[model samples]
Target: MNKKQSGIIVTLVVLIVIAGYLATKVNGPLYVNDSDFNEKTAISLKEGKSSSTFFTEATLSRDQDNAKTLQNIKALIDDANTPKEQKATAADEYLAVATATQNESDIELALKAQGFDAALCSIVDDKVEIFVKSSKKELSKEELRGIQDVVMSKTKLEKIDVKIKE
Candidate 1:
């Protein structure tokens, strides 16, 4: 590959790796200071601390970020300077990211449809981190199992965590 092709490939790989590391763990001591956690905010919905506004904002931010990234990838794919191989690879990665984004939304909606007050689903590589809100402070065994069933049916990811809020 030419220098330009190699550079583009490297950049795409790095972005994919970083995206997968975004997160899904909410069980930890609350960090009042913003610097204590990743700026992405989606990294951990703060377990029991998430309010409806926070949940809405987090999902909105995540989707906006994905849209921006997808736009950049599309530019690369359309660039005349991009090699054929690079374009093909970029297209595949673009599709993967887009599909994952849609899957996350779908999972959330399905969970809500199942009767949860609010739901957030994060798909990080082979794992999925889910947080659901309800009036009850504790989730029953059946409730937890039902959440898992919704996710499993929607996605085949290996590790799924239905985090117990707080």
Candidate 2:
């Protein structure tokens, strides 16, 4: 090939290589073909803690929001004044609330994707613990009931130790 033709071909090859690298990096972890996805959260659950879906990608999405929530939850745990037992209890409460919110959101997204009109089920910490305004609202009674059933059923869980709130 002539010098000009060789130069053009070299440039095109370099560009193609760069483009191929970018494509692989972008699509490497999409899990499109996989049936399940899961990533570790900032706060590690207790050893016995259980989750509905073993591999969950929805919980992994909106990571920025999760980070902020985790920070706030940690602060709450730090701010609590009590004995070790009390602190542990408080931490468990916090985990339950946080996990419930994340789990509910993941469930909502999945349900919505499957053509179910879904809504956020408020995390029920306790009878006295009123929900703050930040929690997502229930979309409908039927959806809420459906979520309630799922949450209560204790089936399709990745772990067996985590207790479902009734």
Candidate 3:
């Protein structure tokens, strides 16, 4: 092949590789699954901790996802091409998301402080969901009530759901 044609081919190959890499990075898994939580809990227990600590692998993965989402919103808000009205809307959403993320962190800490092995909380559309990791794979009524009370007190949200996982 001619040198010019060879050069063009190389450039196209480079661009394709770059596009693929960017797509994978942006489209990566955004949330952890049940198995991830279970594996993290098992590892935590094997490490000799009586109770799992805050910020397990699953929790960290969640935090990373939240951070990326917030960052994207901020970028949209700052983009000059975005309409003023859209920017305003994005700003409001950013504030709400930031607040909810902070509340989730606080709730998780409160659950841990209350002697739970590990906990994760998420707020969506005014509803709160909590996932607590327990070695026993089950929680008593009182335990569930206590978690609900803590969540209510912390977030002041009427809709709260708690799940215990082993």
Candidate 4:
């Protein structure tokens, strides 16, 4: 082999070795978008085999304070600007609207599924808002809308807004 060819071959060999070492030394894959880190890192940090662990529904009964709030909602709905005799007819719609407009369980589940720490929930002005915290991005608007739709179907309210902590 000629000297020039040997020199080029040696340079290429050195580059390959350096590249291999760098790749191996990397602690984790590069994350560019919010989701890139949220999904993958969340997956790694979670323990055990099931993703279900992260998505488990927040137990309502466990939170005595929120349970009392829910009781107050029942009373409010009873006294809402609607007739008593006609209440039965609107029962389905009432339940649907109230729950959809105020339900926070599903939202809690979604937040947990995404590996975020979510709180019980608070009902303000007939709206259900949840407080969530995490190193990752907060829950998305679309997700909250879906949960709201479920609760809205139970109430008399025409529209409801479900807010997530920022």
Candidate 5:
């Protein structure tokens, strides 16, 4: 093949590979990986720093997802083809999402106040799930109880699950 033709083929192959890698990355789960969380937590602990210091990217992704969800719900509420009852339901769902997002922030702040580095809360379909980043990488029974107490008190919901990550 001519040098120019060979160069074109190589460029095309490189582009294909790059596209495939990006596709997988975009499609993967949005949550922070265990290794990343652990590494950040270790460094923070070593430096006597809070987990929030390293939380920017994960928190931004979570906020973006939350915004997208709210936007989608708002679109449903505003759609002309939607029935009145459905629109009303969508409005309620939107409120729920907004409240949940606020509650997540409240929980994160509360955890931080109590000395945690980072925390995330998600409320869905009557269930609340919390993820906390602790220096120890795991929660003691007392810590779990305390978290459950805080979440239940804030959300007024009986169902809660809390996970601690490094």
Candidate 6:
């Protein structure tokens, strides 16, 4: 790996160690809103679904999408007709998505360990999108920061957007 890649891996390892330390030292369940979510997932917010149920449903949808992508990647890899460069690109994408999936799982586990009722983390490019079920509609600055820190520690992303999963 190149210097930049090695540096990022080192930073991620340190952040993960820190996240494990921080995860044991927080409390509270709350949420905020992102305008982007309001625009995108407006339908899912209706009908007063239970927070845990909503999280389950949304996670299923996301997993389904990821599975489809993985299947396509597998097809590309298996097909002798496909170009090597295309297969290589698909393989890279597969690894990145798999890593992001693990990172999301870790972040959610950490948030729940921090006392969140339900936490859903999605990493898109360099941005992290978090959907959390809150006991209160508003989160204090400290609470918000705690959530962001957990996510940032698990992922290389610094741009985090949190939304209410009510």
- Tell me the number of clashing residue pairs for each predicted model: 0, 2, 0, 17, 1, 0
On residues 68-149, what C-alpha lDDT tens digit does candidate 4 reach at each position?
4445545545776867765665565456445543455554555556555554444445555455543445556776655555
Q: Relative to the true structure, how large is the alpha-carbon lDDT of every model?
A: 0.79, 0.47, 0.79, 0.50, 0.77, 0.81
Which candidate, 2 or 5, would have the higher lDDT against the true structure? 5
The reply for model 4, stretches above 4 Å from the true place, is: 1-86, 89-102, 123-128, 135-166
Cα distance off (Å), candidate 1, residue 14: 45
lDDT of 2 by residue, 46-104 (tens): 33433322113223443444555666556656774656776677688667756766665
* Candidate 2 wrong stretches, greater than 4 Å: 1-73, 79-82, 125-166
Model 1: lowest-lDDT 10 consecutive positions:
23-32
Per-residue alpha-carbon lDDT of candidate 1 for residues 4-75, written as tens digits (9 for 90 to 100): 999999999999877655532334432233355475544444545557865777687687678778888998
lDDT value for candidate 5? Answer: 0.77
Check candidate 5 and list the clashing pairs. Answer: 51-117
Writing each residue's lDDT as its tens digit, candidate 3 over 43-110 gives: 33233433334437556667766887788899899799999999999999999889889889998898
**TM value for model 6:** 0.69
**Highest TM-score scorer:** 6
Error of 3 at 151 (Å): 1.4
lDDT of 4 at 21: 76
Candidate 6 structure quality by residue, lDDT tens digits, 1-166: 9999999999999999988767755642222223434546544534478888889877886776676677777878879999999989989998998898889889999999988889988888999999888978888898899998898778868899998765
TM-score of each: 0.67, 0.32, 0.63, 0.29, 0.61, 0.69
Ranking by lDDT: 6, 3, 1, 5, 4, 2
State the displacement of the C-alpha of residue 131, model 5, in Å, after optimal TM-score superposition.
Answer: 1.7
Model 4 lDDT, residue 16, Cα = 100
